[model samples]
Target: MKTSLIKLTLPLAAAGLLAACAGGPQPPDWQLEAKGSMDRSVAAYMEGNSRVEMAELERARTQLTRSGRADLLATAELLHCATRVASLVVDEPCTGFEKLRPDATEAQRAYADYLQGKVQPQGIPLLPESQRAAAAGNAGALQGIADPLSKLVAAGVMLQTGKASPEVITQAIDTSSAQGWRRPLLAWLGVQLRRAEQGGDTQAADRLRRRIELTQGISAAARPLTPVTKP
Candidate 1:
């Protein structure tokens, strides 16, 4: 996915691109570095590379700090939080972004609200192209998003908003699976597993359990090996 993809959700992630568009000069090195780190961070997180995600995110944050732009840093933090939400890790608020929200742009604030499922009708147009449809209560528009990650994030936002349908869940699962995004694939599978158990569909529950286990195994195997230390 392009680094600019996140800009669809919020204006902060593409500070470099915005600068370049305003004139003919290339973006400063700091902006390019920050944007690249931010892009890699999200991609790493989606692929379940927790170590790389945190490292890249910190690198982005450091670069943004060097630019003395609190709002840009806030945007980076919000993007991290939003990525977590997309993977179904919804237990936390975007405290990091909130701390610096005063410096954020109106569009950035709107996106923060949208991710929390509290976005107003006026803010619909400010959201990412994929999320705008869901924010407007038009879940059907999710189908029109060509990017799998974008579609999954929109569906995840729908879940947070209590507007998710069975089809939305299935679509999220299929999208994550297609992208080999193990983090979200496992998360959506867990959702299905819970529903199967609650509905007393023993067969379906068992299948989901096995699938989850298999996915977990793949994730474990894919992790970088740690060298053994001599005792």
Candidate 2:
């Protein structure tokens, strides 16, 4: 009887060990790599480096696909679409936004809604009540997000809807500029400048234009050097 009991206990212990080994960590290496690439892409976008941003995004897509992280992949695809919109690539229509899975996190969903509204402000009337509510709420909630890109999108949405004062948007842009996020800083300033012009606020428009010019100079100075040919 003792020998039989020992045999049963040893098999159970071995099976438990096998289970532990198979389970491994929660997020595997590919998931981590994909997330890391996504982060890098966002950072690049903030810094006004579109080339690097697109390249890093591609890496993230590949890694996420390999890891079977479908949710994150969908989020990345949405981000790619947002970047294209930000870059004003009007020639190519943004696709795949409608196909994003519904299981995305709240933050992801909010960001996507903000992007959609930005791309098609007229379509806001067609959105579900819940989506409109989320977009409105995210205008304030997204300010607290750690990622600069998310904060910028939130600010943009608020600015478009007249929910955020120009001062608030200016403050957000200033904060990003202080952190060296030149691309987004310039973009937001341009939006404000245009609004001021349309509103006939000459003083505000001039101030914004000067700010835009200064930021453009800084961005040009910070750009990576290209090979020069001797004539």
Cα lDDT of model 1 by residue, 43-133, tens digit: 8888878889999999988988987877678778877887876788776789888888888877778888887889888988877666788
- Show the lowest summed lDDT stretch of 10 residues, model 1: 222-231
- Summed backbone clashes in each candidate are 0, 0
lDDT tens readout by residue for model 2, 51-128: 887898889778856745445566566656554333322234345445554654444444455565552444444433
The window of 10 residues in a row where model 2 has the poorest summed lDDT is 1-10
lDDT of each: 0.76, 0.53
Clashing pairs in 1: none
TM-scores for all predictions: 0.85, 0.62
Instruction: Candidate 2: list runs displaced more than 4 Å.
Output: 1-26, 81-99, 102-111, 118-134, 137-147, 221-231
